[model samples]
Target: MTLAQRTPAEEAPAGASYPDLRWFPPGTHITVRGLKKAFDGNPVYVGFDIDLPKGKIVSVFGPNGCGKSTFINMVAGLLPIDAGQILFEGKTIAETRIGYVFQNYREALFPWLRAIDNIHYPLRLMGIGKAERERRIEELVAGFDLKFDLHRYPYQMSGGQQQTVSIMRSLVIEPEVLFLDEPFSALDYEMTLIMRDQLQKVLVARGVTTVLVSHDLEEAVYLADKVLMLTRRPSRIADYMDVDLPRPRDPSTLTDPRFIDLKARTLEVFQNAVRAS
Candidate 1:
């Protein structure tokens, strides 16, 4: 469907009371209220609510099968929300320009396309000219430090390399809102750290509104400005936390006392959610 033709669930009435977060950024905040979904008569989510501000990183944490992925997918217009409302940048979720990075890098990147070509594909889809596309691809290649010889195909690249390309592909679209569905879940220990650091820089530099769905506690602490901890399937928002330490955080921050304190609080909430379920 065309961008303008898309629509989210419905509009809020005039003067409806809702939380406001205009202090963060002037454009593109994601607000979800009473979101519910079911598949094959099996309920996955119910009454989930969150307000993500622009230019901020929001991490979503939940147990397995809690519908975190489903939540993001519905926001991306990949699936329909059975109930509730989702607003993006003061517009319906369907009308927003969003970029999605799937949990599996191999599934998201085209195996047949070269690194540069894969990055260029979205530009082509947008009808950008050859010159501009090539220029942007060159910038991305340099910025990501992509190898010259490995531009052949996705199969030739390492897991980490494929992930870098996947992120670049999503960012190249200049999406106002980006959804990363466990993009680093498959990487090894060292690669995960490297990519996590790199992703923080990239997202910060662009002021991208980001939502990351991850189970890694450290990752959620390192990359997120606010972490939304959710309950198990038939899920709901359990707690919304603000990472108040500082900016330009490093992996070392995970070992800090404050980080430990924050993690402990989030874990307590998670455990309580489990017991309640």
Candidate 2:
């Protein structure tokens, strides 16, 4: 049977079946049902379920080794799950269009290709013609308000610039979902701040369903509409807190009482998760 036809029992994880059909919350964009994974005989996730909302940014933060990157990778279909099903708006991964921005910009971009060419590569793979590829690239360049030249090779550009290209490449496809795994971790403090602002503008404007995995607490709360915090191994949701802070959040937002309080709360949950581990 096709994925869409599968019953709730069929969608359940191995050895753990449920009769009730999984109910997605309103505006849910992605659904993960009974997700299970293991490596070297050690279980990471077992019977995990989550409903990610449409047109919003959800940041995944947790204690170290709590499977933040693992979660997104599995959802993005980069890594295989041992069992269970992940669907995008009731469609399987093959039927979904996705974009991923890896944390390591230096390794993610093509050293030989010009920045513009890197952005065009995915479209080419999708059988998009040269004319359309050029049009999309032009649109993204304009949307990003790019100041630097795109003709330069990745090796010649600064770290922040390379990451910018990586983001643009992911976005060029206009994917239904965008997964970013620590996209700014390598940049210096000054550059990280700038990239955050740039990313926020494009993502909010496009309203793509985005899942970001970050190690930094402040960065996680600053950029997210909701923060999904996980517990230690055999990870479970510690808290899925809504970030009600108004956006176009600037550096000044850091000092806002609400922002500060939310960050403190997130940190507290994180510390408790760690201690429990």
Candidate 2 structure, TM-score to reference: 0.92
Instruction: Say which candidate scores most in lDDT.
Output: 2
lDDT for each residue of candidate 2 in 60-158, tens digit (9 for 90 to 100): 999989999999999999999999889998899889999999999999999989998999999999999999899888888888977799999999999
Compose the digit string of candidate 1's lDDT tens values, residues 189-275. 899998998898889888999999998977887899999888887888888899887868887788889999999998898889888
By TM-score, the best candidate is 2
Screening candidate 1 with a backbone cut-off below 3 angstroms (N, C-alpha, C), the clashing residue pairs are none
Candidate 2 lowest-lDDT run of ten:
1-10
Candidate 2: RMSD to truth:
4.4
